[model samples]
Target: MDAMTSKGKPSPRSSVRPLSNEQVARLGERHNLVDVTRYYPNGPRMPDAPEIGAQNPRATARLLEGVSIVMRQRSRVKAWGYDRVPTNGPFIVACTHVAMYDVFIPMMSIFHQGRRPRFMAKAEMATWPLIGRWFQLVGMQPVERGSGKALAIESESIRILASGRPLTLWPEGTLTRDPQKWPMSLKPGVGIIALEASRRLGREVPLHCSATWGAASINQWWPWPRRNVVSCFDDRLPYGDLLKDMGAWGDEPPKELVDELVRRVHLRLVALLAEIRGEEPPAEGYWDFRTMTRKPWPQDFDWRIGSSALATETPTDGVIGESGVDPGLNMVDKGAQS
Candidate 1:
């Protein structure tokens, strides 16, 4: 067993030890008791299980739209690319997430464009203090990260898109872990869900790439008289043909197929980041979140976006194999946000 130090801190040897079920249970009543579920059935009972979220999404969408209108006005937010968004049908809006507060940017932008956005958000949001219920009422689908419920989330997401509402998902899943905060490698679930949605609809669901910068200012707790721009790139993906071409439309998509789809999305995200920064990006590669060690943000107040050194880093092998790992669907380490 690993030892603890005199200061109540873990010893160096105790840093990353694995625990048995019995040992884990003995650590605390919360861990030891399953009887707590009798009182709080949905409250962290079987904490590792995947939760699919509340039923009845359309009703929630209605309430969320009303709430976002007030938030939009207060934030003084603006959006570019109304022409780029689809006006008549169901579509997928894939965006880069830099800050949790910035989720409002996409919410307001899409709302003003005449569509309600159904987000595939973290399951914890359903139980967050004040806004947890609001999240459920907004038709946000909750997902337990890394519980192997990605396919469950994808199924629900496809249903939301089929309903003709714009479904917004952060392909990065979490904030950019890049030292420079440029867009990182995207999770493949967005591509997979878009493909599946298009297959169900008998046509391609347009995938719009959105990049939101300046939202980082909100993290400093002084958001505004300053501006936050939500830029929706003009490039839209015809996912149906792309999927068929890559052989992803079959009963089971191969690992290479999904990787290629994610790669295509990553390239476009990099281009969008370059456009937002008003500078040229690295010639061939970007920082891979799976393998890169992220740098912490500055301690003082600074509104500038973080970025990485322009090095040609290749994606690490074995980081994600045929069974694609959805890091966004995996555990969230909120340290990246700070």
Candidate 2:
């Protein structure tokens, strides 16, 4: 609870920076922008441009407003877990990307915990009119996702961590289309980052993996939406001297060592899912003919089945739903504590 307030102050640090929801919304509506990014000031600059990104006062507020809109218009999501997040220090955060709004849980949680979450986004997202400018202003480093660009990302991550700012990343690369896909797989980019940070900083950066359950699914929208909950789990991967104890070079090898660290994170997430449901495992592949129109699975687990690709072809939009006016994600409904 003793997190330094210096990091918690809203970006832009001025009331006149035009980072408000109303202003951003008006700009987005008129410009047809769906996403925005802000880059934080890397060095001193004029007061007019002042700072961007992390300093972009309106980014978080506007995003929160948008999230609230989705909650009201779409399904409900009962959220939980600000108590578990840390208030300070530079750590590497790994979260399971289950939905598009997954980014918000960490961001909002940190907001409540009095810390700002710094995340990495794709470089191309910078091209979006209003959205890109926001990200560029927020001090978020852009990484090209793929093998060829891996070094660039690894190097940037090392620098970010060295600067003593915690980094939050969705190690899964992409959202699992089916949460039932238990620990199916993940890319090792996270490992690469950890390896580099350890070698450069002479310390193991704390790595925490998180998961969210019942976050409003694909069709969930704004105004009065369905409830969603996010439960997070954390563990540490000692990088500093742990690497020497295990005898590894740089951060990339022994592949087995890195694999185990990654797997442990996955296992922690799997346990969280099982614990939340009080079940053996998710019915991820539990496709049903009745749900031929969608990726079917009930809110409460029952109709048992396993590992079967649906024989029936369902249209993607079959389950598409319109959101009502619920201000969805905006309400941090710390429903019954899990």
Candidate 3:
């Protein structure tokens, strides 16, 4: 049985519960808004523009300048957790994609924090007018989708991390088609890259997930009364345990391990989004991009549970044995509870 809208069309199920006027107002009070248009140009600048590998320095500067102009004139940006970003070293930032313009929010936020991380974007973005060419010149790794070259992409991502550079990726692969704009199921390549790169470098890579809200409400054409855009960057997600058994698995990590890693990233993004929106995520479940349906949340799973409680007890053969429990939550780490 499916739900129907007043127009007699089937309504898509959503996990997001809408917020009331009072709730939205209360959430609004917590933000410390900065009018980017007024403050950005005069604000403290990064001591020196960190080199972005082989990217064209002049082009990267110009591209960022243009992005700053558009963002400042169109919206106010509020971001936190920059201090949590490692000042130096290799790290991965997986961010949520709510809207097209939202990409710049995290890009600028990371730049402001004085780290110049390369970004993974669709290959088509390299062809966009005005900024497309600049994107390529500014460390954008263009991903060619559905081309049967996933391994190549994954290798390149791992290479970047192994080279001691920061990498930012929108793991959802595209703007979320979630009816409520919540993050959808992520591509497994993010998990694969994180795990493989760590093995190559002999340490767990610092992986962070970030969520942004407010840009979706803005009309890019006639921007005014600048919307309050807020972004939250989480500290490193707990994944050291995932790497402990890597040696036993030989070359390819098990599908179950990769899937569990992806699950953790998805859950973390969902939690961060809930905090930013001040609305609880759909308790019913998360949206599945492939099936275009809402799946039930893992049985007894709580978004507030610490990372340890979220770890999966991955079984061999890449499938969860029937224990009548969600494989993703078969075991809870009592020691890791927050």
The whole-model lDDT of each prediction reads: 0.51, 0.46, 0.68
Best by lDDT: 3
Q: Candidate 3 regions off by >4 Å?
A: 1-54, 305-338
Question: Candidate 1, residue 173: CA error in Å?
Answer: 1.4
List, in order, the clash count of every candidate structure.
5, 64, 1
Ranking by lDDT: 3, 1, 2
Task: Please state every model's RMSD to the true fold in angstroms.
Answer: 18.7, 17.6, 11.8
Clashing pairs in 1: 60-137, 146-329, 180-306, 180-307, 180-308
**Candidate 2 local lDDT, residue 42:** 16
Error of 3 at 223 (Å): 2.1
Candidate 3 C-alpha lDDT tens digits along 267-292: 88887787777767787789887678
> What global local distance difference test value does model 2 have?
0.46
Q: Please give, for residues 113-186, the per-residue lDDT of candidate 2 as tens digits.
A: 33355687666767878767766655567756654666676677778887767687866655543324333344
Please state the error at residue 254 of candidate 1 in Å: 3.3
Candidate 1 at residue 253, lDDT? Answer: 51
Error of 1 at 264 (Å): 2.0
Give the Cα-based TM-score of candidate 3 against the true structure.
0.78
- What candidate 1 gets wrong by more than 4 Å, as runs, is 1-76, 224-230, 245-249, 282-284, 293-338
